[model samples]
Target: MRLRGRKGIRETIESQHDLVVLNPAEWKGRWAERFGNEKPIHVELGMGKGKFISEMSVLHPDCNFIGVDMYDELIRRASEKARAAAGREDGSAPDNLALALFNIERIADVFDEGELRRIYLNFSDPWPKKRHARRRLTHAGFVRQYVRLLDSRGEIHFKTDSRPLFEFSLNSFADLNIRLRRISLDLHKDGPAPDNVMTEYESKFYEQQMPIYRLEAVIGQEALAEHEASLALAERQP
Candidate 1:
């Protein structure tokens, strides 16, 4: 999946920053300070190819965004976009964006309990095979990690085109009893709800006339929900 014309500025710095990061904890605690602001934190997990998040940092200057992905090559592109935005160059993007190379399973180690204000899962792999259910981002294993990083009633926003994955996610959320805040079986026909923000994958899907399923789940008053715990971060964003 080689993208043409993506090497904007990270081309120069990517060699300097060691694009691949094994642990997110390095940048976890002071992620806020990374932007020189103590503002609210919102994260987008699986920021493929880097589009939605770079635009978000431009649109919302108040909130600091953290984009996490495991792939070093993809992260390099994201870093380029962030650097461009920060410098306000011709092909550069908006500032206030931080990219991290993190295993989503290590979310807790990246942020303390009740630290993050929100989480976004855009077009995550369904892992539809029964044996691979544990790999799904919305599965109990990942949900547990989210609870630790999430602030009280912190929300997890998700969107996907996979029906099986969406259904599985719904049942998993209820089984955990974290609280399903909003469930839209088909987001496009939801009668003018909140305007949907387009992610890179999302935009492609729409052009192909694909319908996206979406939902938002939140943490409840329960101290603990039906889920496991987390593993672990260092720093150096994607």
Candidate 2:
């Protein structure tokens, strides 16, 4: 669903600097300063078209939200959506929301250790081929990186329509012995949860009678210790 050849997409994203972060690395460890508050920061990796993040920002004014995606067109679209949600015609975003164009693999470069309070992975690419498993957002390597950026009470909330991806993610987290909770194999079986925010893809999937899977990975001290031990063992092996 990558958009290409969109005229002026880059210009549009740059024009809304208030909503789009062009140099996120500079904001590392200072996200609160960027938001002008000390509220917890929540990030949605691979945020597509920005429906959920924008809505969440409006709903939770006490928290700051950052939507990260690599595509210029998608960032531009999200900026527009953020502005529309805030009812601003002058291209301003909601005070708590910001969109950024960056590669998810290099996320650690933009946020300092324990900087993020929550991370969201909604309908992420499954990367179905077995050989491409490491590219999955929930891969153990990526999970380790996420663990480094999360505070002691931080959490990673993941949702997907692909069952295989869900299973793979479950195994990945288990390997690290990370604590998980609120796991749902069929998220909308009894209708959407009261606090759930649906992304555009999720909304379409729901209408098509697709089941969504979700889980919350908590970063507890014991789990962090195990993760560090595993990394140490790997280094020793090599």
RMSD of each: 9.5, 7.7
Overall local distance difference test of candidate 2: 0.90
lDDT of 2 at 118: 93
TM-score of every candidate? 0.79, 0.90
lDDT of 1 by residue, 82-133 (tens): 6555665455444467777777776777887777878999999888789999
Q: Rate the local accuracy (lDDT) of all candidates.
A: 0.73, 0.90
Candidate 2 lDDT, 1-238, residue by residue in tens: 6477478877877887688998899999999999999999999999999999999999999999999999888898888789888886665689999998899988999999999999999999999999999999999999999999988768899999999999999999999998877899889988776689999999999888899999998795755576667778989994
TM-score for predicted model 2 compared with the true structure: 0.90
